[model samples]
Target: MESIFHEKQEGSLCAQHCLNNLLQGEYFSPVELSSIAHQLDEEERMRMAEGGVQTEEYRTFLQQPSGNMDDSGFFSIQVISNALGVWGLEIILFNSREYQQLRIDPIHEKAFICNYKEHWFTVRKLGQQWFNLNSLLTGPELISDTYLALFLAQLQQEGYSIFVIRGNLPDCEADQILRIMRVEQQQRPKLIGEDEAQRMSVQPVSDTPVPGDEAPLDEDEEELRKALALSRQHMEVEDEEADLRRAIQLSMQGSSDPTSPNAVVTAGSSHESGSSEETLTAEELRRRRQAYFDRQQQAHDSSTAGEVKDSGTKPNQ
Candidate 1:
């Protein structure tokens, strides 16, 4: 099996990354596909903005050669299928949400595109073992079927979907070639050490744990648990801070006293016939809050730039 990462392009080109991994050493590159997709997307957006009619022919635009590779960061199943078709490979797509057993040959090479929270990663199965080629990771990591299923289930709950990709071999020669490749992979030397072996092993967790029963955690497992907890805590703190900032901004807009610390005034408000202590309407308050935040953001950005400039300038040392 082969694996590749999008590196700096992971955030916007995950679909392209997966495609590159699947079509390594091909004439076409992921960069080319991305460029083509972006151009088509821009054209389509322009047409839609001009109130272009959606006829049956318009619906099939994606099937046309000019628009086949077009996408907006994420590739639809049709886009992926059409791209693969260019290389003479037929795509067989399966949705993970559908409750149907996949009929696949264990020995044949296959690539699985797993989606979680709009991020994509590739996976492959060899016999009973599964390997994950997540772009963020250093390399392929061994994973368990139970872990894969649980991960997919959590993603589905968050409104994400998974798609499995299987390409049809062109002829018997291609099938034999893949079988040989699999045999070579199986014959590769085993390099798992004690730490790696521990990491690859999956410990089952029961729904109900008996009192006073707990399994000992390995060093790696303990560190991972601590990291996850710290990350969750940091996210919760950020959410609270954002909510508090929004509340303060809104409160400033609603204050009636012009002299109050939280008072906000729009243009021409002071020239109105109403008294200085007049409360604003909900719509006016919202607009004022938005303007206040915009000003605050600009000020913050200016201060940050000045700080950066000062830091960059060396003191007389």
Candidate 2:
């Protein structure tokens, strides 16, 4: 991890300045980080110290007690991958109009389980600038959606806005992912930006049908909201019975293609023709659904048996 922290030769002080700003920023919590830092090893600790990682800026940051956002100092932001090589988070100052971008050292490669918190956001890169939302999941734990959601919720409460990146995940897996993140996300309300607020304040002149503009319902589209709600329930069942081995196998295969849209592509006739899209057969979908329900039933049975043994609930004669 320290290998990646190799200081910028050109922006030595500027980088430090940036670090100081981030440590003092309104969107960050230094007290929380101190708790995190206490868990570091000797080598990691030395790396931070040698890098002047400990400074008055951070000290001042820690002085404030946990959970107080009002006392946070200036806005500081940096994109950093944690000590664990597998994870990365892109940090950006909320007020800064310019986007900061970073790319990996071309020679190194690994499958990053990219996730983010806050609101749904998109990513784009132009010249040296990069635009994306922030996140804080690292290493193996980074793979879980639940963890990603929790981190976002925590940051939101600290006054940092989140923008989640939605890459290609199976609908089933994606549903389970949200469940894990649901608790953390509950604390955060839907965030609106300045532009959105302005738009909201400016009410449209007419709710009645306009000449050229028809309501969205006129156009045929999937009932995404309804389907998603059902899908959410469907996915919970799948998570209980999800074959970890099969999921891993699919993940590995998905990584190899690089061009594939989803982490787990459904094999089909279109797949044989080299079409980019992935599809699942009805049979496959049904099988997964069945497996999920079966798992849930088994769990329910076990819980009932335990209740009976403990005499927590009376059994039927």
Write candidate 1's Cα lDDT for 1-317 as tens digits.
34322222344465666665444323335666665566656677567545544665555654455443434465555556556667676544333213133433322445566554335556655434545555444344554443343233223323344455655522323233444453222222221132444553554556776455545666744543342221111011122233333333333222334223334433222335662343444345435445654766777779877887889973344
Show pairs that collide, candidate 1.
none
lDDT scores in order: 0.44, 0.29
Model 2, 88-152: lDDT tens digits are 33333321223212322211211111212111122221112221111111100111232222222
Where's the lowest-lDDT run of ten residues in candidate 1? Answer: 228-237
- TM-score of each prediction: 0.37, 0.25
| TM-score attained by model 2 | 0.25
